[model samples]
Target: MSIYIFDGTMTGLLSCIFRAFQFKEFDVQVSTDANVQTGLFAEVIDVASNDEHAQRVWQGLKLKASDSAFKQFYYAFLSEQQQAFQHCFNFAIYVFQQQRDVSKNYGHADVLGMSQWAKQVGREKHRMEAFVRFKKCQDGLFISLVSPDFNVLPIIERHFKARYQDQRWLIYDEKRNFGIYYDLHKVHQVQMDAGAIDRQTASGHSQSFCIELDDEEVLYDQLWKDYFRSVNIEARRNMKLHVQYVPRRYWRYMNEKTL
Candidate 1:
């Protein structure tokens, strides 16, 4: 058994495929360097990420794979699960070994696994786009904090960038400790200083940012809450149906949910 260790990047993953084919090492297992596990008898190989090698494998996959298969490969990778990486590794190898498109071969575990994982990641991306609510800061920047189930900040970037093109905004993923900043023109990945803000406060459900909110933004929040309150019909309330559509985990992002 051969174990291939990579740097946990899309390029690194493609590089792994390139090496696997280059050496004709068919029996293999894939893992990121950050979370590598090995068997005592297994032969372990460390893979270095190379753009040229990655691009070659990427171009090859694109030529052989159907459009849906190509998209499924990327979305599955974004899932960030160790099992998903293994499925991607196996799925790519299967694609290269076959002459026909095998994307719909649900009987094959790897193909089905990749499709299922992609759907889960895709669902999270849509939920983040719907639930994210930006709070206006004193400096005129809109900021929102999210802790999604999957690593979806990259996937949600285009949606926010297109929708809020004229304004500057930052959507930070507290779980991952990183954020994306949109300056009227482009979006950039960012990180905040450890002591830059307090993550929690006495009221456990507050935004708790170190920065101050604009006075008008606070008033706008209150008015929005009042509007929300006025529209409620206690008799028609359906907790089960509401919770199904708007999960409890995302309540913190909605202004009306805050006290």
Candidate 2:
């Protein structure tokens, strides 16, 4: 038994595949260094990320896999689940070992697992795109805090960048402790201390920012909440259905929900 530990990156995972073939190790378990399991009988191998090796494996997969299959594999990796990583690793191995396309082979556990994982990450990506709400800062920067179940900021960046091209915006993932910032020109990944944000805002309950907010932002929030209340039909309310569509976790980012 062989245990292949990687750095939990796409490149690292691909490098692991390259090393697996290089060493002729077929029976292997993939794990990130952070989640490595101890097995006294298993031979442990640490796969370092190598761009050349990764690209070689990627190019080979591209030749064997369809475009949709390629996307599914990438989306599954973005899920960042330990099990998903192992499935992705196995899926890559399966793709190279077989002569025919294996993407639609739902009978295979890795193939089916990758497909299901990709769908879940895709749904999270769309949800983040739809539910994200931003507030204007005194410095002309719009900021929003999010803690999505998956690492979805990478997938949702294009939507926000295209929609808010004229303004500077920051979408911070409190769970991941990183954010994407668009400077009206390009998008950049950023990291900062939570102290810069208001405790209430970070908690998803209050709009009071630690830093100065745009003077009209509070009025805008109130007006929006008032409009929401006015249009809400209390008698026709269906909490169960509403919560089904918009889960309780997302309520923190909604102004009407906070009110």
Candidate 3:
């Protein structure tokens, strides 16, 4: 058994595939920094990520597999589940073995698993987009904090960038300790602390984080709460359906939920 350790990026995984094919190494296992379980009998090989080698494998996969397969495989990687690399590796190998596209081959465990995992990741991405609420900071930046189940900051970048093109904003993932910032021109990933305004325990504004750039922001919060209340009918309210759409776990990040 041979264990290949990589940096846990798509390029890293593709680079491993390049090496594996070059050496005809079949009995293989993949280990990423986030998911490493060393085996006693396994010969450990450290893989250096090379974009050229990775691109060759990627282009080969595109020729051998369908576009849907390629997309699901990508989403599966983002799922970040345990052994996700293993399944993705297996699926890639399977695609290379076949001359034509076999994306709907549910008989293959790797194919089925990747498809299912992609759905889970896609659902989480949509939830992150809807649940994220930005607070104004004194620096005139719109800052939002999120701790999603999967690494979905990448998926929501385009949505926010297009929606708020004129504004400077930051969407911080507290769980991962990283954030994505857009400054009118382009978006960049940022790494920093949550800030001194740790908690929002104020009367009308209570959430995971607090930032006050403009006092008018407080009035906006109140208006949002009042709008929700005015439109809501007590007799027609359904907690079960509401919880289904906006899970209780994510309620901590929503200011309107506090009201």
Candidate 4:
């Protein structure tokens, strides 16, 4: 038995996949920076991230597997579950060895596992599109914050870009402490320290944030609340159904939820 430790990047996982196939390491388990497990009879191997090697593996998969299968593998990786790395690896093994479409092969545990995770990731991706509420900044930037279960910003950005192409926007993941910014032309990823941001926006700071919604923004907020209040039918109100769909975890980012 063998264990592979990777840097937790997709490239590192792909590089580990390359080594797994090259060395015929069938009885193998993969671990990322976040999850490393031990086995009594396992030999540990540290895998380096190699972009070229990873790209080769990806290109091979492009030829051998369905487009949806790659998404499943990617979504499984984003799952960040303890066994997700190994699940992705086993799915790859089936694809490489079988050289046929095995996406519906529920008889294989790994295939089923990847599909389940992919479904979860896809659900979150769609939910993000529905739940995201952006605040307009003083400098004309639209800022939204979220802490999704999976890394869904990658998938959700496409929708925002397509819908609001003329606007500058930033989607920040408070948990991840990184954001995706979209200018008129392209999207860029940015990183920030939570402590630094807190200090910068502290009471003594020159400018305020979060609380800095100007008068116009405050009016917009009121307008939204008033609209919802006018349309809300007390007789039809269902708190259970509302919470079931929107979820309490995401309520902080919603505008009308504040009302």
Candidate 5:
């Protein structure tokens, strides 16, 4: 058995996949940041990130799996589940051989786990698309923060870019510690702790905005609260149904409606 340690980036995982092909060994384990103790009986290999290798893996996936399946695979990778890594590896190899839709195939335990995790992560991604609320900054950049259950920072870029074509904005996932920055011209990944952009100045932009609440914004918020209180029917309140539809974790980010 051989153990391979990767840098834990998407590219690093792709590089490990390439090395796996070269080694041709069974009983392999993929890990990140964990050191392997040297022993006379085992071999340890370190894989380096290679864009070419990542692109090759991507190309093969594009051919063997549908676009949706590939997206599920990506989400499974971002799930941060240790066991999920091997499951992804096994699923990739299976797709290469089966050449059919194996997403629903629950014949294997690992496949079933990956399918469940993928579905969960994908659902969160869609919910974020619908529920994201951005706060406009002084520089006209819209910003919002979320701590998602999965690494959904990568999945939100396209939706915001297409929907807000003429705006500069950022939607940060505090859970994953990363964000997507869309500067109107293009969208790119950005490190969260790099710098600070004031969340209050409305400088050069003139479109309807959604911004973070501050002391000055209390009036608008109170108006919303008043509207919510006035419209609610106390007799129709169903706590169970409301909690079932919107989990408690998301309540902090919601406006007056769900509070």
Candidate 6:
């Protein structure tokens, strides 16, 4: 089997698809930087990122798959999981031959895995929408930090940008090590330095201050915690349900316990 290595971008994936078509005569294994290593007796091919090649693959996908299927594939592509990439690539090829209806074949392991990953990624996206709390900085910028299990930073940008149009903001994902910085004019990806990030206040933009909870802020936070604690009626409190709704990993960031 021939092994194809891609650059790990949407365009790079498309280029790989193009190359795969050219080498259809052989069985191919696709991989990226995170998990690519040449095995004994395997031939490795690197897929070049080309706009035209990407466009061609995109056009083919649009024709073969429904809009919903295309979106599912796109999000699955961004899952950053090695298995997800393989499943998505295989699923895309399956769609090319059998069309979007191939999803009905749930018996396939790859199809089931893709669906599970998409559901997980989708839920994280929704939670970020519901739970993100932005604090206004000294410069009138609203900022927040998140460390979502999945790379949902890119997905959160559009929602925050539209909801808080007039404000400048930065939302950093500590897990992914990148952030979205909105400077009123445009939103861009930002890399944080360890030194700068260590000095960040609750506002997330301050370079030389600790996040001090003032009396009012502390009171508000306590009120929120009280409300959260009070709302859980002991009779109806199901640990399983609570864990399902909000995972424990995210509890560390909840205002009541997040401090």
Q: Candidate 3: where is the Cα deviation over 4 Å?
A: 33-40, 195-205, 208-212
Using lDDT, rank the candidates from best to worst. 1, 2, 3, 4, 6, 5
Candidate that beats the other on TM-score, 4 or 6, i.e. the better one: 4
TM-score of each: 0.94, 0.94, 0.89, 0.91, 0.79, 0.80
Error of 5 at 188 (Å): 2.5
For candidate 5, lDDT tens digit of each residue in 1-259? 7777888788887777776776665467777756646557767778888999888987887788767667767889888776777777767666765757765577866567777788888888888887676545556676777678878778767888899998888877655667888887988888856234332224322112343434444465567669978999999999899888777666555556433
TM-score of 5: 0.79
Better of 3 and 6 by TM-score: 3
lDDT of 3 by residue, 9-58 (tens): 88998998888888888678887753567677868899999999999999
**Weakest 10 consecutive residues of candidate 2 by summed lDDT:** 199-208
For candidate 6, which ten residues in a row score worst on lDDT?
A: 205-214
What's model 4's lDDT at 121?
89
Weakest ten-residue segment in model 5 by summed lDDT: 199-208
Error in Å for residue 41 of model 5: 4.8
- Which runs in model 1 stand beyond 4 Å of their true positions? 33-35
Q: How much is the lDDT of residue 168 in candidate 5?
A: 85
Between the candidate structures 2 and 5, which one is better when assessed by lDDT? 2
Where does the lowest 10-residue lDDT sum fall in candidate 1?
A: 199-208
Write one digit per residue (lDDT tens) for candidate 1, span 154-253: 9899999999999999999888899999999999999987367665566656566788988798888889989999999989999999999999888888
The best-first sequence of candidates by TM-score reads 2, 1, 4, 3, 6, 5
- Candidate 3, backbone clash total: 0
lDDT tens readout by residue for model 4, 176-198: 78899999999999886654433
Off by over 4 Å in 2: 199-204
lDDT of 6 by residue, 77-163 (tens): 768877887777777667666734775466877666777777778888889877776554555666566777678888778988898
